[model samples]
Target: MDGDAWRPDLTSPVGFVESDSEGDLEPSDLESDVESVGTSVISGPPADVLEADPAIIVAVGDSAISAVAATDLDVPVVPVGDVPGLSAVDPDHVSNALESAFSGDGRVRAHPVLVVETPGGGRERAVFDVTLVTAEPAQISEYGLSRRDESIAQFRADGVVAATPAGSHGYAEAIDGPLVSAAVEAIVVVPIAPFVTRTCRWVLPNDGVVLSVERDEDPVVLCVDDRTVERIPAGEQVSIAADGALSTVVVPESADGRD
Candidate 1:
């Protein structure tokens, strides 16, 4: 096992996508990502998972590609190849990364995945770095929330975000969400394109934080990860919490490669 990759249960690949070429990622340009396990299971795109059981995903593409792929598949990915946001990863060392990851060799970092329930009585979960809730009308909208049953925030804006620490560095940070230590058990909540200048982002503990789009007649969408096609209609209270830990990859200290 390599010294740099963390280890988690790898009994089955919830989903795995690979690209033979480099540069930018286009899932349609690559071969099918799904693998055939047996007569009971078959391989396909992320939308195929609605009929399949939930499983961990290994996305073999750049960060942007991997993020969308993983989000669609509804699982976390062991990013392979050239991923942008996942800096310092050696494309050549991917094999070593797999070995260390499956063998349980590197440091363990846990990321909380978000669980969303719809007003239509449908439930879906996302292990994305960030989940964005925006207005369906494509205009400014009203936002509401409560933490542990206590009213904390309510405002009008384009949308709001609930991101895991792993996501804090990306969209969360771009929206001015504070980047907290990934090691900490916390969730960052930020108002997206808020109407009020005083609106701010909050780094709350990952326990009982609930956020919702308070509009019912006017619809909104919950964009998981970044799969616009997989958007969920957000007219109901969507519960956000630490449903489970997403196993994050790290280039082991022992493996000689990029950071």
Candidate 2:
């Protein structure tokens, strides 16, 4: 997605969602700052702010932006705190960031969302990545990767992670997975502690990517981002694909020099 595709309109009201841990920065104080710019402010929790349908949302922390991203809302978000893969501004720069966003001086980057499905019609959406790992520590298991019914690779490993391009910079990168560009419509698949000394990692298309537990010596669990969703029985298949993208405002002053 091009950075200039979307820009906030300062003429309309904007929403504000802040983290609870921001001790000195009260909601009213932030609201006052936003109002200082002569723009109407819609101040409340993420859900409430979304309900009002503000022109844009300003999330104040990692947790705050994560909450907004978890929702199915498609509105553009202006991250105001520490958010990975985003050009997020400091809390003190909220006013400047808002001006940049509304004045069309900021760039908008789209982060793809992953849709994960399991047997018996279970489905979930992930903003970052989805992982399938052994429930027990250090337990080896055989897993298979496939796309469009064609086998990609089968190997014995502790687990596997399928991360979005934005998510590739985190856990996946730490495990030797390639860091994918946000503009690339691909998923990064990396084996976790493979039994073999030499293993292969993949950057595959987002659609029709499947991971199955070929041989589960121990139980396995599925994780969407940070939270464990449920245990996966042996032989069950987990499917993942790119669904929609999250639009984020990227201000030049806040960018950490990452693509």
Candidate 3:
């Protein structure tokens, strides 16, 4: 979809039809990104999805290891806005995205954990400091649900989650989340301190836009794998687009370059 990958077949009588239809169906139209929960990856994802190319993308203000993990796996990650050939379906801008991100060459700050207290006779109070790696709450308007404003207005807004199978396990156990298999292609939407209980912790549909974290509090604590990386804050608001996308590269035993 990034490059000029198609052309009219000059020899076929039905040449123009496929080309004409393709111009209408672009990569930009993809809004939903699904999650596959686990520590070990599936040999091959199911036949349903049109797999995304393994990318090296940096979430601005994300942890340093965010980039580190991508690099170690030899995935060519740039920041969310860095890749030049990105589809319009991608909300983050790609134009100035690269240079702006490269400036953050070092320092991949980690997320913090908060100790929230339920204020007596008041809404729960969560005190946190914003750093580079954590989540916050945002409005529903940001996700193109404005047309359904009547329905959305009833709900309070929220943030994104970087859930792994291990993390999902903890969240589910702590917040009454559904017991989704670590091997399943799933991520839970356990709404943090939600206004309504019914709308909480939905096993997200495969084709969903898991809403981005908000920037309400100056900082929010991200619950990373059972440990607290204190004083982390929320950055750009974006959906929980878990890159469940994996590849089957041969894992060579350690020594040197043996490919």
Per-model RMSD to reference: 6.8, 2.4, 19.9
Give the distance in Å from residue 126's predicted Cα in candidate 3 to where it truly belongs.
23
lDDT of 2 by residue, 1-259 (tens): 5565456665667888887865434456556655765677787788898888877887876667667777779878877766666667777777777766666777777889888898758787777788989998889888899999999999999999999887787788889999888889999999999999899999999999999988767998998887688888888999999998878877755757254
Model 2 residue pairs with clashes:
none
How does each model score on TM-score? 0.65, 0.88, 0.31
Best by TM-score: 2
Query: lDDT for each of the candidates?
Result: 0.54, 0.80, 0.27
How well does candidate 3 score on lDDT at residue 141? 14
Which wins on TM-score, candidate 2 or candidate 3?
2
TM-score of model 2 vs. true structure: 0.88
Model 3 alpha-carbon drift over 4 Å, by segment: 1-154, 157-162, 205-208, 213-236, 244-259
- Per-residue lDDT of candidate 1, residues 85-173 (tens digit): 34323545544554554556655344566655544555455444445455454577677777889878888878788876656766777
Ten-residue stretch with the least lDDT total in model 3:
250-259
**Model 2 worst lDDT window (10 residues):** 22-31
Judging by lDDT against the true structure, name the best candidate.
2
Clashes of 1: 6
Error of 3 at 228 (Å): 8.9
Clashes of 3: 19
